[model samples]
Target chain A: MTRTTYARAIGTALATAMRDDERVFVLGEDVSAGGPFTITRGLVDEFGKDRVRDTPISEAAICGIAIGAAQSGLRPVLEIMYIDFLTLALDQLANMAAKAHFMSGGQLSVPLVLRTQGGAGQRAGAQHSQSLESWLCHVPGLKVVMPSRAVDAAGLLASAIADPNPVVMVENKTLYFRSEEVPDTVEPVPLGQAAVLRTGRDVTVVALSGLVPEALHAADALAADGIEVTVIDPRTLVPLDLDTIVASVRRTGRLVIAHEAVRDGGIGAEIAAATGRAAFDHLDAPIERVAAPFEPIAVSPVAEDAYLPRAPQIRDAVLRTLGRELNREGCRLPRPTA
Target chain B: MTLDTGHQITMYRQMVRIREFEERVKRTFTDHPGVIRGHTHLADGAEASIVGSIAAMRPGDQAIATYRCHGYPIALGSDTSALMAEIYGRVGGICGGYGGSMHLADIARGFLGTSAIVAQNIPQGAGAAYAAQLRGRGDVVLTFFGDGATKQGAFHESLNVAALWRLPVVFIMENNSFSVTVRTEEEDANAAAGEPLATKAKAYSMPGTTIDGGDPLVVQQTVADAVARARAGDGPTLIESLVYRLSAHGNSIAPPGVPLHYPEHEAVAIYGAVEEYEAAKRGDPVPRFRARLIESGVLTGDQAGAIVDEAQAEMQAAVDFALNSPLPEPAAALNHVYA
Candidate 1:
């Protein structure tokens, strides 16, 4: 096993994929200069200008070109420096890649991967740190994958590149520097499969993207109180593992879904609804959700922290589902490692 | 005019088919209550531009056109019924009823697709041609847009890129003298075309020409030269085909004259006065080609009418098939968002 930062893991995956397939190429603004975060550092030197293309500041044109290239059998990995910038390319992402196959009656496929960074925590402000996974999840043909750990981020990205459809593999801007032990072996994690980090019987906690670590911490804290909690990380949002989530809820009879996206239309709502509908008979308590409030994320660190759901929120939701109360000490559970 | 006669006639028939089809679509929109609720633009007068360029391509060649794409796809070999069903929003339509008249895309026939977004297809068409060149497929692409499209940034950018890379693509400017109510002359053609649309091709270091688009055969000759040049690895070409739209910008908008450049009465007399029967008959390139075929002794009028009738019947069957096709499964709508 090689221990590496999330950024390094992404670079390694790109390097490995490019080495294996000549058709693989990278394009985006500032990509040739090692990317906005230096995630693609030294790639241009090795892959040459043809493979590592630096495009103009036209995000839509970049994505549209990638779609055209992918349709023509080129495996293009487009980097949208930030998730907020994806709004500019929404037409290509939503109208072109998302609907191409369906409109073509399955005769054509767009095997393109868009690797973008999202999530708040770096105090990068509203525009730089939004988690708009829900917006992508609304589109039917696109696959939305956000890995919780360095290992899955690397593995899932490889699988996404191999997919015959368009894949939006969003990495957390906060997680780029977050290091973890990644397996040296090249593994392609199957999309739509949820990873159970911790198993408990009292509540089934489903978290996505960068929130899984915080969820694990909440589960660990709840475990000490004799309240068993199972933490499920949905690696992919579009091809959601509703079956696993529902089954876990059925077994536990309680659910608390957490995410960094806005609460109203977030992936958590969908999961909660699916769990409620599928395992309603097994519920011992109502489902609880911890998510960002419905509003434009503010740039202030204080406001951003308040905007994102923390571990304490997750822990509180778990205890609430278990019918437990922390009194005044509930505010001082433990700071999240995120 | 030898072996190409069959192909040329095929191309001519394609034009006739589109003219007829667009005429029928206009009639359908007018007669069928609650069919198309908005302004509908019929390519009533632009038959030559569509047929001429389409006839210039070989198998595996690609085409990307504006919303006025009826003739391009017919030339590219899309089924008439598929097009009819598309206008009808039928389930089995080319885009599964998702794309109506403005959003037709028949991938199998190499009709890359059409977008309602004006001038949006320019860069996309260039990209497709780039892909074809990169793949070494020897396939050239023909992209068409209206006089209005030439004013878009995408048009200029795509032309620059296509020229820079010497990509196998042809950019056809359908100078139909109007963009809705706006006339080409009113928009300052000198500034827009930059010394005639054909000379603008020279800026990209490629050959360009303006053709008489009133004659589909002449248009075909010009387009064929460009297509052949592209296939021979000579790079991109810019073709300015000067044709008349013949109708109001669409069903809702009045003719070009009402807005300014030309007289409204003349615009109507020329474009709107196209008899419903002639609009439907020569509406498609096939009817005009059939007349030519009879004059040339290649076939009798009866034979050509039979072909047109058969084409209509085939289209009717496709419309029925599409209309009867099942609606998409509710859950199927959730599929394909990511891939």
Candidate 2:
């Protein structure tokens, strides 16, 4: 195993996929120059300009071209600079790429991977920092996956490129520079599988994308007071590993979902509703959701920090589910071991 | 560039076949109400342009178009019976009735499917061209859309990239004089300024030409030159084929339980221009091509009559087959959601 940043892992995955398959190529605005976050750095030097292409600021056309190329027997991986810009290409993504296979009655399949990042910690303003994975997960023919660590960043992307259907890989901008030790030869993490980071019995915390680390921190903090928590990271959202989540909830009897997106209509609501139906009788208390407020991500660092959901918020939600609360001084009173 | 007498007759036959197929689709609204659901667009007046452009394509060449899609696949030799059944939403349809009138695709014939949205298919065609370039084959792709699509950003973006990359693609713009109910001149700056829509191609540094879409031979020659240039890896070309649509934009759209039928041509219904519509009818390309062929001694009147009779009979059989095809199982909707 070797230590690497989340950004390098993604770049390694791209180079690996391109080397393994001649049909796999990359295209987007400034992708040849490594793009804004530098996740695609050095791809052009290795793959050449034809395979690692730079395109104009045409999101819709870029997406449509990827779809067409995929249909014509080429595997194209396109990058939309930021998740906020995905709105400009929604028509092609939601209409053409997602529906091509179903509309053509299985005659066509778009093996295209659109890699983009979304998070609100960089003070990049509302236009650049919105998390919009919910919009993509709602589509029928689309497979949405989000990776929270360097290891998953490499593994999930490899699986996405090998996938036969169109997959959207939503990465986290906040986690890009974080260092983590990953396997020397990263293995493809199958989509729609949740990883159980920590095992406990008191509460089940379902975290997504950027919130996985925060949930782990909260679990550690709560563990100090004799409260045990289980953390699960659902790597893929569309074909969700609901069976694992339901099983976890059934054991813990308490669930708290967390994400960086707004609470209303977010993926948390869907998971909450689904879990409520599946394990209604197993719950010891009502479910709690820790998410951002229903407003645009602010430009100021202070307001953005307060607006984002973090470990403290997750910890508080876990406390609430346990019929307890954290004081205003950010102190948790020790309780009897559960 | 001259086509042989036999090839010319074959082009004439394909044009008649498209006209007959569109005429039958139009007649179904009255002859058998409720058979075709949702929206259905006809390619009555653009038959010459469709046939001529498709004639320029060789085997292994691909074509993508907008919702006015029936003509290209027919000219490319897809089964009319399955095409009609797809429009009828039957189980035996080309797409298993998953795609209706607006989304017809015949991959085996190199007819990549269509996008119903205006200008959406342009970029897709460029992408297919990109793939063809990588395959190291001389195959080219033809992208078909209407004059209205030129105003969309997809058109400008695709043209710019296709030109910059020197992809093997031909952009065929059939200027059918209207975008739904509005006249083209009212919505297009080039048309308002008395310029052919093809002039927009110059911005991308590509060859652009305007031709009389009512003449198949002229369309055949113009598209052939563009296709050859694309195959030679020079760049892309944009051809504006001006033809007047002979029907309304589509069948009248209404909610369920309200009968649907074809409304009058927008020229008469919206613009109150009966004389304009009548003039277009007098110059309809189907009969106009027939007269030119006969006068030039390329085909006798008896031979043209036999061709039309054969197309009419063929389309009649297609209609009967569609009417008899079974409806798809409702549970089948769950299939094909993934590969």
**Which of the numbered candidates is closest to the native, going by highest TM-score?**
2
Chain B TM-score, candidates in order: 0.82, 0.99
In candidate 2, what are the lDDT values of residues B1-339, reduced to their tens digit?
799999999999999999999999999988998898798999999999999999999999999999998899999999999999999999889999999899999999999999899999999999999999989789999999999999999999999999999999999999998989878889999999999999999999999999999999999999999999999999899999999989999999888877799999999998899999999999999999999999999999999999999999999999999999999999988888998
Q: Candidate 1: global Cα-lDDT?
A: 0.76
Candidate 2: chain B TM-score equals 0.99
Considering the two chains of model 2, state its CAPRI-style docking category: high
How high is the lDDT of residue A278 in model 2? 100
Docking class of 1: acceptable
Q: What are the runs in model 1 whose C-alpha is more than 4 Å off?
A: A224-226, A326-338, B1-11, B26-41, B89-100, B150-166, B181-211, B221-238, B247-339
Off by over 4 Å in 2: A328-338
Worst 10 residues of 1 chain B by lDDT: B257-266
